[model samples]
Target: MTVILVTGGNRGIGLAIVQAVGTRVADATVLVGCRSTANAEEPIKELKKLGVPAKLKALEITITDDASIRAAVKVVEENHGKLDVLINNAAAVTLPKSTDLTDVRESWARTLDCVATSQVLVTKAFLPLLRKAEWGRVVMNSSARGSIGRNIALELPPSPHWLYNCSKAALNLATIDFRNAEVRDIPDERDHITFWTVSPGHCKTGFNNFRGVKDPAEGAEVIARLLESKRGEISSATFWEFEEGKFQQVPW
Candidate 1:
């Protein structure tokens, strides 16, 4: 059976994705990772109630903590044996807004640690298991605010989110870098992985403290579509927009 592991899957976009995937693809079993193992239990039950195969995963992963990262990877590897899909959806923002580079140094670091560093640590920990899969799929949950093009055009809204933006931009680059290293380095082009830096747009999630204009269910549906899309592999790394029942890859 196809297996998927999703981080921060208790509520918001994460939980929605689990339900959408379960409803759309009946065969796949989704492992929902939560900070507190206890909190994850009910959600798993809810998924089961919805007739979706789901499991609760106990993983308190601070992107900055190496030991926790290793432990979570071990749990998945030992328990599931093969992780076909990994969704880097666990991220957070700190108190003070970092609208520019001149923001508090420590706050910036913390934001980057949770938002960007976590992605790198996750990829490093699960690369071996992903490579073992017949077809590996990784989705890096990003935002439109991270686009350099948007910044250049003064399109991104002004917020005191310095490290958050930096971290996402860094994550985008890391996504591309990872694809290049993992796919291009392999002698056989067919032995490759599909990695994407997709913007969830303005979604109503805790990420924006539910102040977003878009609905969480709609946002999760976009990610679900991507996972169940006809194309197995992606062509470029960019700001991807999901609307009107399609994914439009845009310039980064």
Candidate 2:
């Protein structure tokens, strides 16, 4: 069975991703990563009631805490021996309410730490277990608003959440860095691990107070498609999104 772990799987797009994998991916075991196992109970129950085929289990993981991160890795190592997929889906951002420089700085720092730095640290911690699998994949949950290309081309409107965008841009860069380090340079195909970044496209989640246009399930389709695709069918170090019933690459 493919051992898939999705951080922040307790709700919203993360939960939708778990459902997608549970129903769509064959012989899959999904680890729902959350701050507490108790936090995941309701969602797991709901998924089960909906008759999801894959095995679902709660995994306690607090991305901002080092001890929690280490503990999560240990648990997965003991239970699964190897992880086929790791989805870095958990992220937090506090929008600054004022134009004050100090407030902006603090918000920026915290957002970067929560969204980008912690994801890299978590991926690093699980690298050994990922390597133990036949084909390990890491998917970084990013946003289209983080695309520098779109920003430069005037494709997107100005937004107040600059810090969040900046953090996601850093995440995109980290995805490329991991791909270069693990897949590009490694001569042995068996040792190669793929890394990717995905934009879920403004899903209606608590993060945005339900202001987004798409449903969480709609936002999760790209990731499901990526995970289900053959290793050679998709390339690493790429950004992706699902729009208008199809998967497409997003500019960096």
* Top TM-score hit: 2
Prediction 2 TM-score vs. true = 0.97
* Alpha-carbon shift of residue 67 in model 2 (angstroms): 0.6
Tens digit of per-residue lDDT, candidate 2, span 1-252 = 999999999999999999998999999999999999999999999999999999999999999999999999999999999999999999999777687999888889989999999999999999999999999999999999889999899898788788898899999999999988875578986688989899999889999999999999999999999998998789989999998887999999
Error of 1 at 159 (Å): 2.5
Could you tell me which 10 consecutive residues in candidate 1 have the lowest summed lDDT? 54-63
* Reference-based lDDT, residue 185, model 2: 70
In order of listing, the candidates' clash counts read 4, 0
The TM-score obtained by model 1 is 0.89
lDDT against the true structure, each candidate: 0.74, 0.94
Stretches of candidate 2 off by over 4 Å are: none
